[model samples]
Target: MYQYSEFDKQFVRNRAAQYRDQLERNLAGTLSDDEFRPLRLQNGWYLQRYAPMARISVPYGELSSEQLRVLGTIARDYDKPDAALLAEAQEKQTALGTVPVPGTNRQVGSELKYGYGHFTTRTNVQFNWIPLVKSAEVMELLASVNMHGIQTSGNAIRNITADHLAGIAVDEVADPRPFVEIIRQWAALHPEFVFLPRKFKIAVNGAQEDRAALGWYDIGLQLLRNEAGELGFRVQVGGGMGRTPIIGTVVGQFVPWQQILNYIEACVRVYNQYGRRDNIWKARIKILVKSEGQAYIDKVEEEFRQIVELDGAPHTITQAEYDRIAAQFAPPVLQRQPRDAAAQQVHQIIRADAEADPGYDRWLQRNVLPHRNPELRAVVLSFKRLGQHPGDCTADQFDAAAQLAERFSAGEARVTHEQNLLLPWVHQDDLPELWAAARKLGLARPNIGLITDMIACPGGDFCSLANARSLPIAEAITERFQDLDEEWDIGEIDINFSGCINSCGHHHAGHIGILGVDKDGKEWYQITLGGGDGSRAGGPASPGKIVGPSFAKEEVAGVIEALIDTYRQLRQPAANGRLETFIATLRRVGHEPFKAAANAARFVEKEVA
Candidate 1:
């Protein structure tokens, strides 16, 4: 919601001009793919599985209606134009399969057509095309919208995320949006922090629910009310997921709100100065935190803080400035009315048709949350539905979502870390119409934060770092658990899958975690249980215990199923009937039964074979 100032606008424009020149040189054959790759990557462009995919950073999943409109325009004008090419390729492939032609014009054309366009994560709107020719144009358009692709890739400070419900959530002690925005502005072109050994991630959580997934960030800050009743942040550092995933350490306690920026600057300086740069694998802040010990890190951080405080606090932010930034994020004025009548009518119809309504009902219950306004609500449509490619959104779909956001949701939509779309501020009066529109666009899935809403990564298909195919495995699990009613009855359980140890899918933070690994060139998975994000009443759940070494790909879902059944049998009911309550009950009982069930299932399957 932050508006770009003249300075901000000029900065992006200059970056665009620079990229345009780089693109022009590459196109003229003055620069090769090797040279262009890093330059393009710095600008959020990638050569993906299909064509060249361009990823535009939304910066912590926050966007203005106008900025989103520009994104939609880009998708429509630049990417979707390849639809004709796709159709032609499909026709040619069909022909090639039927006719036994060694060589043909149709075949050649088909090959050319197939070479164009590709798939991308549902959360990232990717443009698949040659970059050099249109780089200048893309730059110019993006600049006009006050956008740039800086630091979206490489070892730079990747996207900084804050709770999507930062200011909106009633349970928050303070809104951390202003703090996140300030950090974003300060870190954009910081000289010392730009080129770390590995990527650095930061997440700010203002919600009681830990929507930012604090346990998985390089640095996670939770806004809290100090004993003095003043706003402050509790700092957690070193949390990361990779080959050697580790939970973050609490390096700092009760950092005053006014000095938040200075504190962050100090923290980064500590990491920048001491973090390993020689070995890429061992270069993350997590490694530093682990090697140095939290006490040592805390001592260094205190010294850094003193130095920063004495050095005039370079990135110091004021309450007034904070207010000015916060003002930009004011919620839209909503109309007062009863819930959508047409949607209610559809609800009735679905209720009458038990089979159809059951799935939708489950989806609505889990995915939809009430809007601040009386007559409206927000819907979080989980694109992370079981075996689907998580966070993959097509160019046309991007444009369509943008259009839909503009029409019904105050021209704004949000992308969740869970790899889902949130149609925030939808009017209840328009719910039916919006639902129909979303259905048409295939964005109307009702699973928001359920087991079926599993987070996954681009595994063997595209990632050079993956050990196996995560998407297909996730799909398999989703298909196995296709019964929505049963899933809802199971309640709020997180079943996160990671293709490899990197854990981009956040397997370490899941109540039920599945991690993909390699065993003698064959795909295998490891299961972990009882982990969670944020500070819960029983103190945050620790990293899950690994249930076994690994299991064959075919046996992964069955292992999960067996664990769930064990959990259900052992669970003690909570007052609200939530799964979190059940999980707490199960955690108290320990992992023996779950492990036993999983091992027994594997043993039985092996005997049958």
Candidate 2:
């Protein structure tokens, strides 16, 4: 985790003050709503259906104990701690057949205290029900902990993500933290990128596992140590999911580490100059790349060359600067213990005993993985459960997570793109105590990358931009798949639901993607199949292929059941995870088999007539 410098702290404080001034002017009627919209969005204030949603950046998903405590403090003190009491008071008034009047006990009801910390797939934290007037105070609180909301909302290269196990992964070629930070630092409030064609996203991955999902980003960079022993980035571009879903294309095969920043600048510069600006629907850089094809590539290369040709080139990184940033991310020294065969045998036997506890076995199977250091392990703190919203946890849980990190590992935790927390340096020998501690804190759910561990946005529940309520669907799916043995048997399936076509769920990459659409004021879900990551490097990630047609909310679970059944029946026998099996089965069986199955399921569901 990189700490903020004095300059960084001052910059954030100033930005908060600046936003405060803008908000005050807007409130005073000096600036109209339209005039103030961009200002608010850039500051992470979105006027949702119910209230303002403030998204705070957890830079690269990194959070120190102090930072996590601050987030909990904000959620506790400002968001209101006694939401249940307020709700009870409201209910009593309602039962008495009286309207809860304003400036009375009703004032407490309007406190809007039920909100919790929401972790997004982009690795940011969102606080719903934040009032516009209190946003500046939130920003000031965030500044105290080296976090901010800039580039989180507007059309800018949003927060840069990297392999969640950046420095600690077993098979990583390099640590992407330094480069990711460099991008975040340089791109922060870059003048040219203020108003691009649309919002942009970038990801960096150095792990052999490609956990970052490189193919689904605006710009995905995979770090590589070539035959010559020099590390550089292999660039992919144009890929995004929304209404028009497409996997990114490789723009640069291998860019030198020194010139990677400048190359990225060139790519965005090209996008900024000529990307569509007329129709909001086609405003994305993905549209431009798809429209122009090779010509787009040519333009980017030319721009990059021009940039490289310039005197004292902009976005150029000096060796000293790179080294300085890299030093901040250098892995800590840890005692190395021999991971002998006997030790493994002992662990396996001990694990089997631990598995006697139902949830403990699932915890071992799902939430735990070996780290690069033989003595340590990476522990995932799942926010997904039967009734819980994906990526959501209480203020107390946040504080407890920080405490766990301080006691068990480093005094830091990392957020995942899947909306979970990661203790990256927990000792393997301490799994029992860690699991017990986390379970008590409500931070352990033991469902990671399974069907029940769904991805969803706030949808119509909060966001005005949504077409339907996504959380209910997610909850339904989780309930339907609550049986642990059956879930494990079904195996690594990804079912992502998006309220609308904005595709915040990354539905395009789910094996079974459900997109909620408004059909004559009713919610209808369009299912997509065979959506997933590339099986190998340099291959396109599988974009969600539409099955047959949309299904009503009631038909969703059955439709998914049919799709899974199709996969179970047709998949070639292999030891691959169920998602990979489903993808492979789709490739071999094509869309027809799944479509036929879905249609048959829908027809059967219609009957009992």
Residue 485 in model 1: shift from native, Å? Answer: 1.7
- Kindly give the stretch of ten consecutive residues in candidate 2 with the minimal lDDT sum: 98-107
Error of 2 at 505 (Å): 0.4
The best candidate in terms of TM-score: 2
lDDT by residue (1-609, candidate 1, tens digit) is 566678888988998888888988888899898999888888887764323556666666765566666665665466532565445434543553422111111122323321111222212344454333565677688788887677677777776787765566657777787788778887786787777767888888887777776767888988888777988888888888767767788877888877777777777778887888889889998888888896557766786668676787656678798887788677777544454999678766644554354545654666667654567777775555432456655455556767887778777777776777777777765665666667667777776666787777766544446676676667667876778667766767777777778776777777888887877766778888877765442236356779966877777777878887887888875667644453576678988888898887674333101
Q: What do the candidate models score in CA lDDT, each in turn?
A: 0.68, 0.79
Residues 1-609 of candidate 2 have per-residue lDDT tens digits of 786778888999899888889988998999999999999899788876555788888777888989889888877666532455345544644663312311111122443335477889888888765667777888888887777889898999898988788888888998889999999999988898988989999999988778888888899999987899988899999988988988898999999889998899889999999898899889888888899999989998998988888635666788999999988886655554666998788766766666678888789888997788898999999888864778776688789888988877678799998888999889877787788778877667777877888888877665667777677667667777888787876767777788899999888888788898888876778998878765232123778788877887777778878888877887666665324455666777789988988878774443110
Question: By TM-score, how accurate is candidate 1?
Answer: 0.83
TM-score of each: 0.83, 0.89
Worst ten in a row by lDDT for model 1: 98-107
